[model samples]
Target chain A: MRHHLILRVVTKLLIGSIMLFALYVQFHGDYSPGGGFQAGVIMAVAFIIYGIVFSLQDVQRVLPPWLVHKLSALGVLVYAGTGVVSFFTGYGFLDYAALSPHHPVHGQHYGIILVELGVGITVTGVMITIYYAFTSRTPVMDDEAW
Target chain B: MLRTRSLFATVMLAGVFSLLSALLFVTLDAVDVAFTEAAVGAGISTVLMLGTLALTRRFESPPAHTPVIPLFVVLVTGAALVYGTLDMPYFGSATAPAQTHVAPDYISRTPHEIDVPNIVTAILASYRGYDTLGETAVVFTAAVGVLLLLSGLRRRRRKEEEDV
Candidate 1:
């Protein structure tokens, strides 16, 4: 599998570009056809492709299983924390206005970004985690097996 | 006639189905839906199915029992759905109850209030913030469940220095 010259080179070129596109989708989602979920999947695909081309062990070395597990929990906390902050500020739970009472619009922008980030992080973590989990148990497959 | 095919071929067919459905969504002007369909349905699912195929047998077992019950169920469900849709308003009808309500408010005020050019985003993240939060939580929960089932905590392998 590792000996495939084209797969390695093409994956190298495609991985960085995919991650970049994921970022673009995340931030520019407000004006585009994407958001956290789509971006998160794209980001995961970048790493998953790397794993498939390079090997699961190599990719996991870069993104350890432990870190991914922790991140899977953290994203929900980040999202819920925004609501908690708003609640403490004497506004409705998850209130965007609480972020900036004077400039409600700016507050909305900030709130949206924060929540989207939380979503993106969780999605990326979960997706990669699942991929790693599935691959870990499987025997190293020969290219000819397919 | 698509029976007894290799798992790879079956997955490829599914991927093609997703791409076709995504194209249909685009034609309906549901760009957001199309994007998701293309990305999640056509892209990630195909990969995941391939992964599963790698782990399991490549070919499906021939049906031992009659598929008549399942076929009848599917046909009934499909007919019910089509019957249900018969009374719905035509596509993009202004008088549709869904459009008559808060959509106009969200569309009209989004520029002044949220200042985001994309009203869909504004509505999804701001107006319907809680729902999105719930959806994210659902995704997180699903991940947690999968982790529990597939890969709970494992002892770090310190002895083997096998490089990836």
Candidate 2:
């Protein structure tokens, strides 16, 4: 990969745009065709492309396995915590009306955004974790083997 | 396509098939599903398959047994599936079970209840919050499973190396 100057440069250029597009898909999901799942996969693809082009160690340094593991669980907690918050507000589990006492519609928006964010986070974490696990193993074939 | 002995070609063909299905999804007005199929099914899975190929044999060995029974079984299943679809509602039929069910309620009420432009998001995130939560938990579980399996293998391999 080091010798492949063209691929390295192209990847460097594409990675930022890919990350940007992932964020766009994430935040714009409410109005667009994409959602947390698509955004999360796109985000993971950016890191993975970097890993494939540069090296696994390089990408791992940028996003450590420990951080990814914690993030994976944290997303589930965020989702569950949102439901618990509604419970505290005198509503049943996952009822968005409790999020906003005056305007239940506003609460729904808030709940949806928060939930989607949680979903995106968990998906991104899990995807990166899987990629790292697979790639970190001792390679049966070297770079030139392909 | 199946006749190709190269695993690499098979993986590439699978990605192509996924992309075609994504296009079909778009035509069916399932843009979100199409996006997912394109990204995960075609892009990521293709890359993952390539990685797997790197760790294994590139060419498939000839099967010891004939594939006639498997071929016959596949044909039977395909025919059954096509027959099943014969009774299905026409595409985009308004009175279809999916359109008649809670979908109508979600579509009608989402604008006032959730105030979001994307009704799918409203239903997935707020209306069906429990399902999404469960799905996230499933993703977390998958990650845990993969980590346990792969990481355990590495540790055992290291121990074997130490013994050697």
Docking class of 1: medium
**What is the overall TM-score of model 2 with all chains considered together?**
0.94
- Interface RMSDs of all predictions? 1.0, 1.0
- Candidate 2 stretches with Cα past 4 Å from truth are B153-164
Question: Using TM-score as the measure, which candidate wins?
Answer: 2
Q: What is the DockQ of candidate 2?
A: 0.81
Model 2: lDDT of residue B95: 90
What TM-score did chain B of candidate 1 earn?
Answer: 0.87
Please, what is the whole-model Cα lDDT of each candidate in the order they appear? 0.87, 0.89
Q: After superposition, how far is residue B95 of candidate 2 from its true place, in Å?
A: 2.2
